[model samples]
Target chain A: MKTLIAIKEQYHTWVHEAFPAMHPLLLPLCNKPFIEYLIDFAILAGSREVRLLSDGQLTEVEEHCGTGSRWGIELSYANLHPADDQQQLLDKNRKFCGGGRTMILTGYNFISYNKQKSYLDLATIATDTPIASCPGGTITLKGPPESGASEKSPLAPFSITPLDSVQSYFRISMETLQTGSSRYVLPGYGSEPDCSIGKNVIISKTAQIRKPVSIGDNVQILPKTIIGPSAIIGSNVVIDNGCSVSGSIIIDNTYIGENLEIDMRIAAGNTLIDPTSGVSLTMEDPHLLVGIKTWATTAILKRKTIHALAATILLVLQFIPFILLFPLLKLQGKWKDDPYMQETGLAGALAVAISLDRFPLLLKVITGKLDIIGSSSRSTCAGKHSYPDSGPLSRLAVFSYAEAEDWPVNGSDAAIVERFHAVHSTPIKDIGMTIKALINRLTKGR
Target chain B: MAFRLDTLNGITVGIAELNGRLVAENSTILQKTCSDWQQKTPFLVFDCSNLDFIDSSGLGTIVGCLRKALEKNGDIKLAGLNAKVAMVFELTKAKKLFSIFSNAGEAAASFAASPVSSKTQ
Candidate 1:
């Protein structure tokens, strides 16, 4: 049997806005994308090939699911006009629907089916028409001709529900987490009924696990953490120490800090969210935690350009001063080299006072390898640190707010100020901050 | 800084009416002003009838006030919280911490109907 999975534009519109970076079908329902359920259902129904039809961009979906080889089914993608109806969909993809019993699963709504039953047999014996569906979509059977019964029995009949609102989204996730398994075939693994675990999962012995939990692959649940009752943890996730996750779904590649009370929320990447109300909060403060997006190519290019310009300007402006002061300072024993400090510490008071230590780094900024003004270039030894991107900071500047504003060096407050400036500071802001830093340095006799 | 206070019966219920916005700049001001107001009665009502918005920091400060009031063997109840403010409170589960009422008069009367004993050490 062949399956045509057709999703309407209305579905894509909601999913696109609901999850901008994520694919709609792949939007996780209890740590598993919504599409996986549909795919699993199609496979269970004995579909040898499945064609996904949508008006929206399917690049992300295609990238994720590929050719459906993982599920041992042929997966193909096609585009549909917003006005296209069921007949139009079939006409457009006549070749794919060739001469066989075709099951058209249309709409953005979710299908509910059990994997345990032999749906392939049911497909053969069941009436040659749409068997069941909600108002949002339907599952109809269409094909040229079929032989007699090929193992005829109704599959475990299930109800397909539409995930329309944030409330429904939350409810579905919570229910799935609570049930630990869905009426449909779900991804991941479970040694027991209540827990569905995925690959490369690491649960610290110190962590507490309550039943009805779903954890995806490469997940690290740290010490003193409690997960469950209703929790869905996705792939490549890290839950730090002393945190509690109940009635929540942590999406892929998300890092949750220690002591965070995440309840009835969805932590997707860096955004802490409430799915019930569809109200998401980009955590403004770092101790609360923030999302860190991998630097995009555009950002890298922009950073490099700014760095190079800043480096060039600094090299030119400081040329005369460096040439004149170097020999004199060296002769006066004030310019003595400190290799030890360079190796073990950031520059000393002498370099800071002279403002010489920052000069070379400023050049690196122009080359686009470093921020003109950024986080203190210090590695985080411990704890969560937040940099504000939602606010005014643009992440490209020299002489961070921490230095110019005289925030205490290397402390939490300073860290906050620097992070705020680093993320918010733009190229124009860099000029202003650089001037402030220079003025402060000169006024302080440094 | 417009506010109102009334005592319904012997319960000594005081209502502080908040209007406009409650944010970081004025959140501290609210806390300081509420401290003095808290002295008038252990059980107080904040009539948020006109309160329109509240952020996380502002919500934190209010929760802090609750902790302070609870510490002093007193209680602070909320009345007429608008949808936006209520949402913020509910999202943080801060709503669970306070006794919420439909109106200021109802909240003030509630304090008299059931006087709370001190659980605070």
Candidate 2:
């Protein structure tokens, strides 16, 4: 059986509003991303292929999941119209669905299923009804039922939870933690009961951990800190000294300040939410609360080297035009600071043609402060909430990918295009796009 | 920031209504305004029902106001802090430093309900 996981952006709009920076599919449940659980469920249910369909941007999901080689399954991604019905969804993905058995998993819901059990009985579970469904999601089998020669329960025993709010998200995460991979294959290893710890964990001897806790990779529990009794700590997190964290989730890349009482709350960077209390706080002070970023060492080195080389070349190439014309234009009162908005007169036009206006930004790229091609937002520096809950999907750069593709500077699809390039771009391709971006910036409307 | 003097149960309380945003741009104005409010009454109640957003500098300014009030043997209580504003206080542990109430009246009344501080022994 093949699986088609149709999670439209509409079904999970709450995820967008609550955690604008996080892709709903990538939201973690028990240290495993929400999408991975779906994938795992599909794999266990006798499916070797899976396709993730959404009406929103999937570049981040794609970048993280890739071809699903790690899971030993073939995985693909596609887009959908938010208004499309089940029939239309099937019609759009007809080729992939084929004339064989297909399992349709739609809506933003969590499926409570046991991994150890064989859901192979679902292959023959044929009725004109949904196998199992919840408020926002349904699991249905499509195509012809496999020929069975024995009598058995047609549908497997399982339930779905409609994940439509932060409260639900929190509830589901806690539920997953309580289950502790017995029903699902959770990340990390458990040398003891009700406790799972990940790689690079630095637990001080003075620190104490209660039972039934899940800690992700690269976590540091400092001196005299108490973790768990039902805590979920995500990757790259640090709990400072003299703190008590019980019944809380410390999401990826967060720093818990000294002596803070975090009980029954979800801490994502500086934002802390008590789902029960319906209050979410954003701390402006990094010392009190902060999000950490983990960068790939080799990938960053490659990107910086390529960006630095390309920027240096561009700087040398534009040196003469900038030196000769910039000062003259400034003295003539024709040089505009915000040239991208509107550059008037022949001098300004000529300056644009030679790419003299982008000289300073290019120098920044050479200094490794900016990328040769990235998002054009100067204020979207790293370590800020530019991209929100997720890591930085876009960056401050000399030229944006939208400029390269000649998309409208502030167009709606600019984000879509920019994110696509941001995820799939190579440093080498970035250089090519940099040249195109400059050319497009110079001549797109002209 | 707008300040009004209120006499609740015979205790003089200064109530400041912070509006729009308390950010870097106008944070210093809040400090100066608080200094003026302190002259009329050291016990102040910050009516934050109108506050929509705040930055670190704005938070620092409010903390500064509280410090000045304390120096004059007075206290600053916060009232009607919307979820967004309350979040700022909660995250920085600033909420722990002040007495918070759902409305301005209650916050002002608290000053009168309690025994007044002894006059520096």
Candidate 3:
């Protein structure tokens, strides 16, 4: 049987409000996207072809489910209008429906079905009306029923609940967690009851875990911390020292700070949310709650190496010019030397014209102390320094990216430009930026 | 927020009715009102049936009122908590700190039944 799943954006508006960064259908329930459960159900009900129709953008869902080859089914997506009715939907997908028995699943509701139960018989069940429904959506069957369908026994009742609010979302998550893998095909692995753990998990010896918990990959549970009895910790999470997390869902890439207590809540990055109350707190102190860095080390290393090589070449080209101009400029008082500070303003302009001021900074780049083109150096003072939005990756460079792009040399706007390049610029792109910086310096004489 | 005082079985219970949204801007009013209510009668019942939404500041204010009542050797019970308001209490583990009931009368009656009230009288 072919399956048609129609999900409207307005149906899950509450989810969008709560987790603005996540697509409503892609919201993770027990470490699995909500849409996957619907797909799993469709496949189990003897669906070979599944088409998803959404009034909202389906690019993320399409990219994720793609062809559904992993589940050995054909998956497709189509656009739907907000005002589209059942007949209009049927008319639009007439080619895919193709006179075959089609199951229509609509709304953003949670379908309660046991994996152990055989729902393949749903294909043979003759029904013109909706089989089951909640306020959020409905399940309807179209086309002719299979011939020689057994009339022996009754099928198990189908149930679905509208996930209209955070309370319902939280309740459903807890329900799925409590049921474990026996009832649903959940992500992660656990041979034992109520304990599903993913790969590369690091639990400190001093930390305690009470079961009925699900933990995802690359999680770090620090010393003196206690997790679970009823907790779901998503992948790439760091639960810091002396913390206790119980009856909470710590979403992926979140860092829970030291000596904190998180109970019956949901935490994503610096946002600590009380799901029941719809109350949320954005922690200002990064030490209390923050987002864990997830950039690949190999990529950073490659960029740094390319920057260093470029700095080395620039240093060699400027060596003779520095030797010839330094003594003349200093004797004429056009240059002033300070061990801790580099030349700036008129002296800085003369040094750049001769390419002398950047000489010492280029040498520092080869030592891995700086980059060839990046953000300006922030003070090393303990509490007064500021960093770019790209975090540690936005290192100080011999020639600032602001100078290359001809933006203001310093301040918040320059930091933004540096951060944008730090996150997105490639090694080859850095070489281009280096050329731009040299041209800008020669033209501006600074 | 509006408050009404009533005597149930000789125990004065202050009922604070919270309506609409209890968020940062208006949460202070509830806190101040609760403080004044505590002085008149230590037993308090927060009726939140009409409340639709609440943020962290509002939750904190309610917790603060509970603390004030406890300091006076009195207690705060919550009643008529809608699903949304009840969810906030449950998530913060604040539900464990109070005697919750379906309505104000039930909550007020419980205060009268408790042995601490008889002893204080």
Candidate 4:
């Protein structure tokens, strides 16, 4: 059987306001991302393939999910139109659905299901009608029901709850913690029940830990700190000395200061939230609370530095050749003063070979305005060009990825190749790719 | 920031109305003014209705003011904090340090009601 999971941006818009830094699908519930729960459910239902459909950007989801080989299932992603109906969805994914029984899971809802329970019976449900549904979402089986075993059968036990607000999210997380690994496969390690801990944890010997707690990776419980009878601590968290955290969630990259007593609150970085009222507060004091910024910004800085260095080298290398050939080419009428330049003769070929045309843009790289290698724009027609300026794949750069890979791409195919590398390439890899781009340009010039 | 003294039920309370963003650039302004305000009357009510944003420095100044007021047997109560400002207080666990009221009038009057108890021990 196959499963098609559809989620619209409209349903998960609350995520933007509450947790602006987090993607809704990646929203953690009891230290497990929300999407994994859905995927697990699909796997439990004996699905060999699952296709994730969303109207929103799914790059982060794709990065997390990959090809689903880890789960031993074929996973794919596709865009969804906001106005697409169920029939349209089936029509768009006709090849994926095929003639086999397909399960359709839609909406931004939490599926309450047990991993131990046999959900293979889910295939016996009637086609095109919701077997189980709530105000949040529905689970429907498509195609003929299990090769004509029976026209209908009762659904395997499950329920869906709407994750519409912070309160619901808190409740669901707490609920999941209380339920533990019995109902779902939560990510953690615990020798005993109702207590899950992740890697690189430093719990102070003097610190106290109560049952029914989920602690994620790289967490530190300082001296005399007391961690919950019901607490969900995310990764890279620090509970300072004499602090007591119970019935609360300390999200990733957060620090709780000394002697602070957090009861039934959600502390995410500098933001503290009252779950019952959905009121969030941004803490103005760093000593008491703050966000632990790890390597992401540092990584960006490092990449920028590398790109700038590479661009600077290119700028210096082309300095003399550009001075020698550029004005000569202009004198010969082969080089234009404007952005659009054509090199047809020896001057043109030498200028192109030395990458003299990219001198102006290399400055942008040095100024940290553009990448050294990224998606390159081209004139598709008269004063018309196509290049991604936004989204995850968009990049402004001196050298194009298509040129780097030396792909014989034309029109839209060039866009496809550049887009692929924009997301996948790293700074060091981009340097190699940039060299390839330069080599390809020199060869093409000859 | 603007400051004025008001006699609330026989207690002289200074009400400091913080305006706009209290970020790093102007946090020192508040810190300097807090010392001057304490000379007149250490008991203060920080009216934060007009405060749109605050950073760690701004919050640190407030905490410093509270500490100074406490040393002189005075108290700093907060009032009229909007949602955004209130969030900052809660995130830093600073809300636990001060007695908050909906308005300056209520916060200042509380000083008169039990001035001795208002002092953080």
Candidate 5:
């Protein structure tokens, strides 16, 4: 069976007002994208192919779900007109429909379904009408029912709630959290009931976490802080010392201040919201409550000064070597002037033997255009070497921090390591990293 | 920025109706007005039904007003806080510091029923 998930722009109008930064389809319910739940349901209903139709741009959704090969289902996307009805939609997507039994999920609604329950019976139901519906949208079955299916037993009932308001969004999230993994396929891992935590979570010894809580990856719970009873802390969040958080959802990239109490609220960045009342307040003072700034610029001037001095010293040491080796390498067809492939010469035996290739990048460090030890340099031109979503901490450097730590020199893991050190490392620490990176480069014969 | 002073049941209660937003630019006005209102009566009620928004500065100003009321053996209570304004109070934990009522009249009436040496005093 094929699934056609059509979500109209009007269905998610409230999401744009509540969370301007988040795409309605990408909204996280329990640290998982809302669309993933629909996809899971589609798979359970025996869908081999899924097509997402939306009036709004589906670029982010396409990037996130990709071809849906991860779920062993072929995923496709199409644009829909706001005025298009059910018949027009079917006519437009006739090629995708292929005249087979199709399940059309039309709305931005939360479908309540237990993962343990097999929805394969949807294929056997002989109905061309809407199987379920709410104010926001409806779920309807199209095409003829399969033959040799049991007609005696009735189909199992399914429920869906319209995600029309902030209160409903909050209520659904809390409901899912309360339900835990028993009814839904939620993210995170837990051995006990009602406690799921993700990777790289740092919990202080004095911090207390009660049951019925869900915490995402890279979360830091400082000393004397209490989390739980009913709490959801998203990824890259930091709950400071002497704070108590109960019955609240702290979104990603947020910093909860010290000695504070967060109860029955939803905090996203600087905005604190009361779910019950649908009230929101944007905090002005960063110390009291603020978004966690990703980059570390506290001692940038000091780091630049140290890097310049180190670069100058290295320039003096390598000046004569570079002058002698460059001409020889150029004559031997071993030297290239490509900016993106600066490290290509380093791969050569002659360049590695005398460390002549690193001399040019030291000039960049001296000019303050690059860090002595940070993230690897990428080209400004469009290509695979260009940095995607160049975050604040992703600075071009002569020597990468990943190399200093002997981690993978490329990919997401390397970027994470670089960002971690960039935010935590001092000028003095950077010097040690530079030395380590230099040693690693020389010892590795590249 | 101004208060509507009224005496209900032998207790002089100052009612301040805040409208629109109480942000950093005009938060000082509320602080000044509440300080002056403290001199006239010990019991104060901030009617916030019309208030739509509040930032951290506005929250601090309210906390300061409560402190001023406390110094004069007086008390400041909150009333008719809309969902948005009430959320700011809850987030900062300022809701715990004062007695909250459903309306200005209720808040004023409660001041008269309570003894002078009650929790606020």
Candidate 6:
């Protein structure tokens, strides 16, 4: 017996737009993809060969499935026209479907079935009639009529639901993650119900799994994090720690950061989103963390324009201060030379008096290597020593928010205070904060 | 910032009611305005029954006000934080910094019952 699965461009478009690098068929529902469910359904139905047909670009699907060698089944991919009907589809693939018994699974619908049940045997020997489907596609059977077979219960418990929106998508995934692989033949193993993991996953011990969750394969859950009761983390993802993920679906290849809260949202690639509302927010700030944007297109000129504008302003602002304070600080031996010192955690931080040390750093900000009001730049050494939750915004600034507020200059509390300002502070606000910092320094006479 | 100084059971407790968004736009105004209120009565309660949002700056200002009150040997408590603003405090771990009450009246009354500090001592 052979199986025919067909998906069209109209349905595939959502997959491509939602997941750029991954194939829609391979996109996991729960921790499994919609297509894998079809494959599992085909394998159960006593089919040795499954042919996938789509009107969209099937290259991604082909690369992913690849003859289905892993499942020990002959899987082949083909394309159909946009206007092809069911009869036309059958005629076009007559050779593949020539076997007297054929089970046709079509459309972008999500088929919900139990792996433990023998639904395939039931479909083969009991139902002789073709199963007509709705708008999302339906399951139909053809070939020859079955011999005197007892009437069987309708496939009510195992229903195929269509995923039309992001809300449904999030719900389905969260449900699957919580259910785990034992209930659904999931790809990975975690022995715990809180973790429904997929195939080929890499989990670090330092990373904390709170359970009642589902995780996909080829995933890296980084250190010092909490993942939850209703979390669906997709495959090929990196969840960096000091982060808390609860009631969320983190789509593939998404990079979450330390001390970040991803609650009630679906983070697909670089897009931080509210999936239920379909509100996609592209975070311009990368230091906090970011997902990878699938499209490589960018306007280089826009960046250059902003940098040039910033440079002109900085050069003008720093002229008098740079010349006057440089020699004075150097003469006092207060201007210490530390190369890439910011990354060494908060300790590698150099304490500069007032507005004196900001002269050089301002140039870095204009060059775009530094954000004028962005995260304080951390030194490489400091980054290594700092704990996952240890103030993620530890990169020291010549003028810190804590300094402006007369708080302790170089402690964890100071780092937290500064980081909060760094994340919320904008360029316009930076100008105001910088002035306040200068005034504070002048009044303190430090 | 609407502040009311009341004496309950011979204890002076100042209740400062905050309305709308306590954000950077007017967080400083709260600080400057609340300074006089802090001086009038050391024990205080910030009634956040109508507060909808609070950014980091607003949070800082509140912390600053708390510090000022503490310096005068008294304390400031929070009351009636809505879910959204409460979420911000929880995320930043600032929820631990205050003695939160269910309502402003409760917070104000708690101060009178406790008499935060002995004025004569």
Q: Candidate 3 lDDT, tens digit per residue, A263-298? A: 888988777788877777665456666877676889
Error of 4 at A37 (Å): 1.5
Q: A246-343, model 4: which lDDT tens digit per residue?
A: 99988888999887778888888777888988877776668777888774687788889999999988888888888887778878878764433576
TM-score of chain B, candidates 1 onward in order: 0.89, 0.93, 0.90, 0.94, 0.91, 0.92
Using DockQ as the yardstick, the better of models 2 and 3 is 2
Question: Each candidate's TM vs. the true structure?
Answer: 0.67, 0.81, 0.57, 0.75, 0.68, 0.53
Best by TM-score: 2
Q: How do the residues B1-121 of candidate 4 rate in per-residue lDDT, one tens digit apiece? A: 7889999777799999998999888999999999999999989999998998887688889999999998998989999988767766765578888998999889888998897745342
Estimate every model's Cα lDDT from 0 to 1. 0.71, 0.81, 0.80, 0.83, 0.81, 0.67
Compare candidates 2 and 5 on DockQ and give the better one: 5
Instruction: Provide i-RMS per model in Å.
Output: 4.1, 3.3, 6.2, 3.9, 2.0, 5.5
Error of 2 at A57 (Å): 5.5
The local distance difference test score of model 3 is: 0.80
Error at A392, model 1, angstroms: 17
lDDT of 3 by residue, B1-121 (tens): 7789988788788888889988889989988888889889999888888887776678788889888888888888878887656655654556777778899888888888882632221
Model 6: per-residue Cα lDDT at residue A213: 80
TM-score of chain B of 4: 0.94
CA lDDT, candidate 4, residue A198: 96
Classify candidate 6 by CAPRI docking class.
incorrect
DockQ, every prediction: 0.10, 0.31, 0.05, 0.32, 0.44, 0.09
Give the C-alpha miss distance for residue B56 in model 3, angstroms: 15
In CAPRI terms, where does candidate 4 land? acceptable
Q: What is the Å distance of residue A405 in model 3 from its true position?
A: 22
Two-way lDDT contest, 1 vs 4, winner: 4
Candidate 1 chain A minimal-lDDT segment of 10 residues: A338-347
Predicted model with the maximum DockQ: 5
Error of 3 at A11 (Å): 1.4
| Candidates sorted by DockQ, best first | 5, 4, 2, 1, 6, 3
Arrange candidates by TM-score, highest first: which order?
2, 4, 5, 1, 3, 6
